[model samples]
Target: MGEWRDVFDIKRDSAPVEEIAARIDADSTVKGANLVILIMAIFIASVGLNMNSVAVIIGAMLISPLMGGIVATGYGMATYDMHFIKKSLVKLSFQVVFALLTAAVYFSLTPITTPSPEMLARTAPTAWDVIIALCGGIAGAIGNTRQEKSNVIPGVAIATALMPPLCTAGYGIAAHSFHFFGGALYLFFINCFFITFSSFLIFKILRVPVCGGVSEAHFRYQRWFLIVCGLVVTVPSLYMAYVTANENIRDSQVKSFISQDMDLEASSVVAYELDHGVLIVDVIGAPLDDQEIERLQASLHQYGQLRQTTLKVVQGPASQLNQEQVQEIINARLANELKNDSGKSYKELANQYYGSYKRDAADQNLLRSLNRQAPVLFPAVRQISGGTLSTLNGEEETEGRQWLAYIVVSRQLTADEAGRLQQWIQTQADMPVVVNIQLQDTPSQFYGNGIDWNP
Candidate 1:
């Protein structure tokens, strides 16, 4: 038990140059392992990023040789080992290159072009990243001081999270995504700087020896090197800090305005996105009533300058809505109704109630089966007697065997429009499938009157 605790403590301790150097040189095969592990790590990282697999990404991070380079660099700085510094830099650069090249090649070969959620996630860095890096660096330093490395390696792997950003960079290369490149590279740089600098601090604090006798010239050289490294790291940190501050300000303003103007009686205003300095709001149903519009405008005007506030409103009909949006609206309304007794979300409720059309997969299969068995030409030669199949309850019944299926369209459709639709459906086939048409009555009513709910 004592031995286990000590080993754990060693894994959680920080290190000096001598200790780190001994560890690096102890394993005769470490250098060779470094090369293989790094390449594999980078490839895994890229795949994980592309697929948005968090577990795969973490596994890649665990296998990455990145921490060794940073550790070596810090050790070099502390002990003034120029050879170690060069070796570490070369190894780190190779790892990075391998990762990037691997990503580029993999993505080029893989047929999937769509960005996975993981890929999208790594496309941005936030202040929280800085916090994570800082904490990780501190923990890494502690782990280094320990003799047992059970926790150190895992801690370093988790804290560094090196694979994600590198993989992100690879995604950029593969997908021609400049945004991915910039964001990912920036994140990688952040990790590199923090890890190396933190290690440097930990070493200096532990009073790691400089190997040779202290000379004024050597001391001055070391001081200058430290200063240069500090400058290099600080530049990006400061820029990231500024960006984080700006994002926070914009987010605060948006939330403040939305919260302050909750009294607006306008049609439900759904927040879509702020793009090109415009807010895209989904206004379900018809345009808001005059009173509702006035209330909305009045409330908005009080919160911010209304001159540049371009709000793109989208109006939709209940009949046009598919099941997903209808259900979403229903859920939103239900939540609102549960909170407020006025039932302001009743319009959404109504939309959901009317829009809930149960689509049957089996029906689609049946249509496909019928279409295959009885190849009918659209614009089926219609006669006055009984030439077309009727759709009375939103279901089409037909045993079409001709070039096209003759459909009895609803009377709501004009002859010209019906002919055009038949022509359109016919075009999908190689041979002309003429649709023979007839007029029939449908129970469903067209709904496009007015806004019914307040969001």
Candidate 2:
């Protein structure tokens, strides 16, 4: 047990206090080679962010001296060296400004204006980023105290990501977008604050001897300023965390509703998105008439997450289907199912999806034919729409082809008129359909509230 405990013992391979202090002092300055490297790193990171290249960004992080300066600032605080604190702060500030300006120039001159995924990623600093910065700072400080210099510093630099956020802020400046500017700057500040604070904690825990410096009064003012800044940074992250959690929960609930509750058999829901309070659904396979759409919109009320969401069902025009779009739909579905069943080939899945689509398309054509004949058959009939449906028998798989029809007319239909229209529909469909004829608020539109079958 003692041996196991000793593994975590931090003092076992401790560096001499003098050596660590000397090392931090060397890292604190931003001049000569450090300045040059900072410039190069800034340009590289900017290009990486613009191109959305992860490898280039990681390469840039490996060479960044930014973390070194941050650690020096933390070390200065631990030792109560007000002179050293002021010096390191000035150097770090200079380095950050130079880095941001260099990145801004590159982004401004370059023709690439689109914000890539890499750039967008750094703009949002979440709670996890804070935790990562803290862990990295602790690890880096412990590494600095080790007798044998390890690679922990570079790894921490990569993990905390000091360079990318600044570059993103630069991009924001170039683009003249305050949202991007504010968000990226906030993220960079989060990284800097936590790294310095956590490193201070580690250095204090190690009990490094105080190397006194001039201007203790300045350090006190700076300390209080940092405390205020920390609070300012932290409050927004807490609110952002709440919003992120809420969105995740809402997403999960909506996904569950789509999988379990959405009951359109003849049609397939290809894609869906919840924008604000509106749910946009794109579907293909069988036809969808007014009633199906209304039922679909009504069903949103059943799910708590979707109760306030407005549903918009989009069906492609009844022209020829786009094979490529259908292929994308099929591929998405098979990607999930094929994970469990490796034996199924893409060809087989494509064939199955297309076969179903062909049959559905034929049924849709039949419905359209009936719609075209409606006005001639009954002059008062303003609109007619329909869709095909399938059903099952008790404990048996049986073919139950059902069709639903909605007819809208300008005026009321008598019993004789309604009967004649129903017979004409059955004859046109060439199938027995159960349609409930009703009289309500008269028809002025295609889908909602009004209708009769005859003139």
Candidate 3:
């Protein structure tokens, strides 16, 4: 026991209380350079999240001063320094407000409104996040108290990720998305509380001296109060963590069940979403019958986490006949019509040709309108071909029609441009239309003077 005590003693390398206090004193005051760094960090993190760049996000994390205020607050609480605690809290609050405002302004001005994976990942906080924050906090406190500080502080900053979640919350606010705002804010709260609480615990364990002379009773009361506050913050986090863990388990079980039992040749799962004890699975290629679906649902009981959950199977929209199938159907119809046009006049033959096929007057009008508008909308477009296909539902192709357009373009269309064209066409037709664009490569230019350039 004595050997173990000597080996595990934290005070052996601990810095003096005065030194630790001075180091965090400047950090606890949010002004000048500290304030500037906080704002810059927020902007960097928000941009990284908006662009979905992990490297940029990590760079932002390294320079973030958000952890300073949190550590100061925790240190103050540990030492029962009222002045220090009050200053730290005020500075921390200011840092949070400024960071959030800066992020919101940046996101509001930016044109890219799509949510990236990096941003989305911060919105959901699990029990593992709380655990990580707590562990990081302990590490941060230990590092701060060391006589010779290593890179542990910066590593803690990156691990805790103090800036990203706040920026994500700001994104939610800027985009007017309450779901994103709420989830991200919750995650940020979890990080702040757990980090501070863990720091307080570590400082107390290190036996750091209190600032002022106080009675034993008063110190004990303050310690209990801090403990209560920590407990209050932890309860909701614990519950949220449990819920997140259960959800992960459920998702894993569902994936395992599908991969192990489902027939991949006949059908394959495209996507799935779980909500309120229900799993909605979207499958393509082949539809599952009632009996097969029931068997699959029964098989889910083997996973204890999903025993009471309901499985709802939905067929994917892409299960319909593809471009090849549509072309085949049109070719067969045209062949039959040509074979039977033995005694028809020129005008009659034209009418017969149009009527035998599924191309009606409305379709022709729409096609003419598209051709007239295509060149105006996209100057690079060389030619356009469009046709209608019977809608496929389950094993049957019904009278319902869907439009398909094939565009030959002189240049490759950007994602935004393609999306805009598709939207415009769909609006004009007052229905959904699938547009596929093919780029026509331009020939390379060559000079006889041993020079070749392609643009």
Candidate 4:
């Protein structure tokens, strides 16, 4: 126990109380050079977040003066120095307001409105953030008390990341997104409160002498007020962290269930929404039957969080098989299964079924036009398939539809020849056409083997 105590002991050195107070007092004042530094830091952070550059953001964090006021407040509160506390709070408020306004103006002027990963990351405060701020605050306070300070203050600033959250909140303000604004502000508040709280604890532990005289009743009231304030900040942060953790778990389970249970070939989850015990999964690929969907829903019971979730499976049009087509596919699959010596794998059978289904579903006139004109224009072409390219949102354009033709060629074709073929196809079909050419050729000095010969 004596050994442990020695290991954990923090011994004060040559740094006098007056010198420490002066330094804290200087840092807490936001004017002249300090105010300029704060504004520049905010601008730099805003730019870094806008450009999604982590290095630039870190640099901004290093130069940020926001931590000074917070530390001063914590130190003052710990020593019961009301004058010091009032001065620190006022300076901190000014810095916060100035930083927010500066960042908001910068974001409003910039054209790039999309949130970067750094920006989005600061929008959500978690339990981990509280822990980080607390630890960082203690480390920072220790560094401040030392006679010879190291680079710990810069490290603490970077770790706490006070600037980015303010910039993110400013972005929200500029974009008029209340959700982003509120969440980011809450994150900043958490960091500020925890850092101050931790600093208070550290100062008290270090047994710093009180600056002014006070009555016993007044001291007790002040202590309770601080405790209540800490609780008020902490309770909501704990709940937010819980919600965030649960959301992450739900997302993981959703992905696992989709990948493992859903047996649709060439399929992908287009979108999903989970709300109030209801999960809506929109999948694009071969549609699942009622029995298969039921099986999937039943299988979800293995994941405790999703056990009570109501599953709503939405089928995309690309794989929405009609009753007759579905029956034909089932019959073909059954026949393939019955003949174990069919010499074709299950994947091959499925591919064949999908090909036939797509061909049948294709526009007859467009398919005929492609089949007739592709060979005429490029005799080296062996197979041709055409389809209209849909937007990412799965919406098909009525006008100016982009028709894509995927052609597999027996021999390599030159860029000019491919271009000519594309123009001829467009002329024959009387539509906007995009030709994707694939070549089956041996490896040569000029070209690689089985190249994607696009023009």
Q: What TM-score would each prediction reach against the true structure? A: 0.64, 0.66, 0.66, 0.69
Off by over 4 Å in 2: 1-7, 213-227, 256-263, 285-291, 298-304, 320-455
Colliding residue pairs in candidate 2: 442-450, 443-451
Ordered by lDDT, highest first, the candidates read 4, 2, 3, 1
Local accuracy of candidate 3 as per-residue lDDT tens digits, 1-455: 99999997878898988898888787666778977887788888998999999999998999998888899988888888888889888888888888888888999999998777788778777777888899999999889889999999899989989899999989988999887898788888878888888889888998878878878887789778867866766677778778767766766786677668665667765445455678766566667789988998998777899899888887644449453443443344344433432111222323433542445556678888988998898786677677776677787857477778777777767677777778887887777798767765543223111111231
C-alpha RMSD of candidate 2: 15.3
User: Can you write out model 2's per-residue Cα lDDT over 1-455, one digit (the tens) per residue?
Assistant: 99987887787788888998988888775788887888889988998999889999998898888987888889888887767778888889988888888888888999988787677777667888888888998999999889988999889989989999999998888899776788888888888888888888888878888775537676678679778977887888878878767777777766666666565677766555566688766677677888877887787677776689888876674244585676665676556444322213343546756766776776678778877888888887766667666677887775677666677666667758777887888777777664543333543333533323343
Q: Which stretches of candidate 3 lie over 4 Å from their true place?
A: 215-217, 264-293, 300-302, 309-320, 323-455
Please give, for residues 257-359, the per-residue lDDT of candidate 4 as tens digits.
8668764676655444555687766566766788978887898878977989988887655546553555454455445433422212333434545654564
The full ranking of all candidates by TM-score, starting with the best, is: 4, 2, 3, 1
Report, for all candidates in order, the number of backbone clashes: 29, 2, 0, 0
Better of 1 and 4 by lDDT: 4
TM-score computed on alpha carbons, candidate 4: 0.69
Predicted model with the maximum TM-score? 4
- Would you give me the overall lDDT of model 4? 0.77
Tens digits of per-residue lDDT for model 1 on 344-399?
A: 33444354455223323323443465454332432332221112222343455443
The lDDT for every candidate, in the order shown, is 0.60, 0.77, 0.76, 0.77
